[model samples]
Every structure is written in C-alpha cells, then in structure tokens.
Target: MAGSIATAGVVCAVGIAAAALVGIGAAAAESQRAAGIADAAALAAADTLAGFAAGDPCSRAGEIAAAQAGSVTACDIDGLIATVTIETRFGAIPVTAIARAGPPL
Candidate 1:
C-alpha cells in the first residue's frame, strides 16, 4: 500500500510540472507575438512621420501605430521618432511590449 501511494504521489508531481511548463511556453509565445506587433507599429508610424514636415506628427503616428497593432495603450511620435506600446491578455496571462524607431538625429 505504501509503495502504491508513493507511485501515485510521483505521478501527480510529474503532471503538475508538465502543466507548469506548458503554461510557461504559452506565455513566452504571447510575449513574442506582442513584441512583433509593437515593432511593426513603431516602424509604420516612424515612416509616416518622416514624410510629414510638421504639425501633430505625434498624433498621426499614434493613429498609425494603433491601426497596425490592432490595439495599443500608448502611441506617440516625437520629432523623427516613433514609439508604440501594447498590452494584451492571452488565455488569462497578461503580456506587454514596447517598440520604438527614429530617424538619425
């Protein structure tokens, strides 16, 4: 009986470990996706801002960034620079990432 109990306990422990590993893998994937989205948004915004001479470039960049990201918490353009931030929840896990791009100053 004691041997059976020990075996059961070991099996349970292994199952728990496997579950934790799966969760971690999922979180990593979500983080990567979020990062990619932010990077693309920042790049698009910077490119757009570069064409503009002046006037509310930040606002315009933000708009472009949000559009590309699908959802963005903060987006802004300063001078020749563009920045974007996005946060999302994937399967009960929260992920956040920021991306920035700028022309030579």
Candidate 2:
C-alpha cells in the first residue's frame, strides 16, 4: 500500500511539472509574437516616415499592430527611425516587446 501511494505521488508531481513547462512555453511564444508585431509595426511606420507610404506614422503602426492581434503601447519617431512597443495578452498576462527600424546609423 505504501509503495502504491509513493507511485501516485510521483505521478502527481510529474503532471504538475509538465503543466508548468507548458505554461512557460506558452508565455515564450506570446513574447515572440509580441516582438514580431512590434517589428512589423516599426517597419511600417519607418516606411511612412521615409515617404514610401502615406498616413500618420504612429497611427499606421497602431493599425498594423492591431491587425496582428496586438496593441501598440508606444511609438516614437526620430528622424527616419521608428520605434514601437507592442503588447499581446495570453489569458490575463500581458506580453510586450519593443523594436526599432530605420537606416543604419
């Protein structure tokens, strides 16, 4: 009976560990998704700033981020450079990332 109880406890612990790992993986994916959105938004905004596109730069970035299932938390343009911060939520947790795009300088 004691050996059976120990086996059950081990199984429970393993299950819990597996669940934790899955949650971690999910969070990492969300983080990566946010980063990608931020990159795309920044690039789109930079294109606008460079006169290759039309519209407000930050507004363009926010729109792009929204289309990608993210929200733009912040956007800043300095000369030809565009920087964007974006957030994507997984459950109640918010994952965010920042990216910048512009000419090399």
Off by over 4 Å in 2: none
- Each model's TM-score? 0.76, 0.95
Give candidate 1 misplaced runs (Cα > 4 Å): 52-70
Score candidate 1 by lDDT.
Answer: 0.74
Cα lDDT computed for each candidate against the true fold: 0.74, 0.94
With a 3 Å backbone cut-off (N, CA, C), the pairs that clash in candidate 1 are none
Q: State the lDDT of candidate 2 residue by residue for 1-105, as single tens digits.
A: 999999999999999999999999988888888889999999999999999999999999999999999999999989999999998899998888999999787
Alpha-carbon shift of residue 75 in model 2 (angstroms)? 0.9
Pairs of residues clashing in candidate 2: none
